[model samples]
Target chain A: MRKLKAVKITQAIVELVKRANFSLRKDVLFALRKAYGFEKNRRAKTILKAILDNAAYAQKENLAICQDTGMPVVFVQLGQDLKISGNLKAAINSGIESGYKKYSLRNSICKDPLLRGKSGFSPCIIHMDIVSGNKITLTLLPKGFGCENKSQLKMFKPTSSLEEIKSFIIDAVKSAGADACPPYVIGVGIGGSADYASLLAKKALLKKIKLQRGLSPKGTVPGLERELLFEINNLNIGPLGLGGRATALAVNIQTYPTHIAGLPVAVNISCHALRSAEIVL
Target chain B: MKRIYTPLDLNKIKSLKAGQEVFLSGTIYTARDQAHKRLVQAIKSRQTLPFELRDAVIYYCGPTQTPQGKVIGSCGPTTSSRMDAFSGFILAQGLRGMIGKGSRGLGVKEAIKKYKGIYFITYAGCGALLSKYVKSVKKVAYGDLGPEAILKLEVENFPLIVAIDVNGGSVYG
Candidate 1:
């Protein structure tokens, strides 16, 4: 068994949170650049240019990309053979407390659903997966509520057609309008249970944009990813929903085997400022 | 591009059309979900507002804490739809304009038309760039709300697009 100190995990979490909030992943930047080059509408081009410029300034100034600085979503890949010396949950929480303070990131977590109170970060969301390895991997995704509030989940009959799934995603995106901050990076999960499907869609969000921007998958739904991307952009929602081309940067999908009688699909949308970071220790 | 100043009068707002880009300068107040709710409640109780609402423009934003030596931190527009329920009441209080991004619900559009108000959309998620336009910021009320606290901001050459015009033209169309 490989022994890892809990403080090492805590330090890595702090760095990951700081880096994720301050700079966007390279895959997201590449997709935005590609969209900027191909966009034909004047207004869309202007919006895209400003977004890219903001990203540049945020990096140079060591500032956050946006003010939301959403709740930190940390994913931990713990090795089965690893032995942790300290309280893992406490270590993670301490990292969030210090990281939020040190970086001046907004603490958006509220104590209650309806009642508003004094501001502080409470209950940072963390997901853990046990994998076979000697190394521990941690990823931080600062998910803003604007796009998160717009996500949807629906359970369909097992006999449902692929076209039905496509339309469902389109409908969700259409209803989202500009509230989700298009052009979005759409994440879709298919064939799992309702909860599993939703979680799968969010996990799909961690996929590199390089794999989703224009690439399509084969088998049960051949080229469906590319097809959905084309149709959604054609909706003319555009950047900031001011109407133009380039409404979505990419569409990524993850699938799982479902029960014999049901098909569950989930759609999770992400804004252009796709912020995430990862580290291995 | 049109240049407009804050404390905007109805006539100045009426001259605007949807889909036109504009640079707004001068003073505007910032408020988001919690503050808006409080404002409406105060109005219902006939309590005096924190600031005079007549001809004032409110920007819906909750900025991050300012680091040392910076004028302000990253500040950008939040989604407009969440505040839709209170917009009519706020407009009735003599607000001439609002700054936010995304589609406004029908009620908000109706309030804009009935009161001859305008809506503006800054580049969403471009907080770093937007912060450069803000000359200064001061807390006006609701200090307990942290980022949601109401703030008075002085700005120059702040860029925005007219998403909804006083005459009811909508960019969503």
Candidate 2:
């Protein structure tokens, strides 16, 4: 078994958080630039241009891309053959705290859901998976609340048709409207149970925002993603919802098998500033 | 495009129309969820406010921590709809304008029309770029709220689009 020190995990997380906050992912940037080219409305075009300029400025200055540094969510793919020397969870939390403090990122996590106390950095949300590998992979997604608040999930009956599912997804974006900030990158999760579907939807957001992508390896419908993307952009919500052709930059779908009684679908919307970073150790 | 300054009055606000791009300068106060709640409570209890409300513009923002040697950190507009619940009362207290992103609730639209106030929106999720306009910042109230604290910011040529105007005209439609 390969041994790794806990402090090493802490150090990696610190750098990952900074990278995620300070820069826009290249894939996302490409989508934004493409949308800017396609947008015809003068206001929409201007908004897209400003968005591009903002991303560039944030990266150059080593600053937080947006004021809401977001709730730090860490995805850990732990290798079956690797062993850790110290408290792994503690190490991760301490790293998050140190990263936020060191770089002046906002402390957005509240201690309690109901009481709503002061914000702090420790105890970030973590999802762990044991995989067949010798190296650990850590992916960080700093989810801002504006778009996160608009996430929707529905348990459709087994008999529901594809059209119904498509409408549901489109309606989710329609209801989100201008409130969550557009042009949005949509992530859809289908077939899992309710909570699992929500997780899958969020995971779908981590997929690269490519112009051309293949069918999901997990058996999700192939043409549905493309159809949904076309229909959503037609909503005229546009960038900043001022109306234009570039309402949605991309629509990514992920699927898993489910029981015969139901089909659960969840939609996760990300604003233009979708920030994430990953590291392997 | 038009140029406007803060401490805006009813006449200046009424002259503006929705969808007009404006470059705003001068002072504005920053307040978000908690600060709005506290301000409402202070008003209800008949206590003195941290800043004057007459002809004032309230920006719905919560800025990041100021970096060393900088006037402020990434200070951007947050969702304006989240503050809709408190806006009617706040507007009645002589508030002249609001700056944030997204569309307002129906009540807020009605309030803006009734009170002859203007609602301007800056680029959403563009905090780092927006911070360049802020020439100076200082904590005005609720210091314990950390980022949520009310702040007084002096800005120069801040870019804004009039999302809603005093005549109930809205760019959202």
Q: How would you class the docking of model 2?
A: high
Please provide, for model 1 over B28-118, each residue's C-alpha lDDT reduced to its tens digit, 9 standing for 90 to 100: 9999999999999999999999999999989999998886778888899999999999999999989888999899989999999898888
TM-score of each: 0.97, 0.98
After superposing all C-alphas onto the true structure, candidate 1 shows an RMSD in angstroms of 1.5
- Local accuracy of candidate 2 as per-residue lDDT tens digits, B69-101: 778888889999999999999999999889998
Model 2: residues >4 Å from true position, as ranges?
Answer: A213-220
Interface RMSD of 2: 0.9
Task: Output the lDDT of residue B31, model 1.
Answer: 94
In TM-score terms, candidate 2 sits at: 0.98
lDDT of 1 by residue, A164-267 (tens): 98999999999989877788998899977999899888888899876443444643443887888889999999899977778888888899999999999999
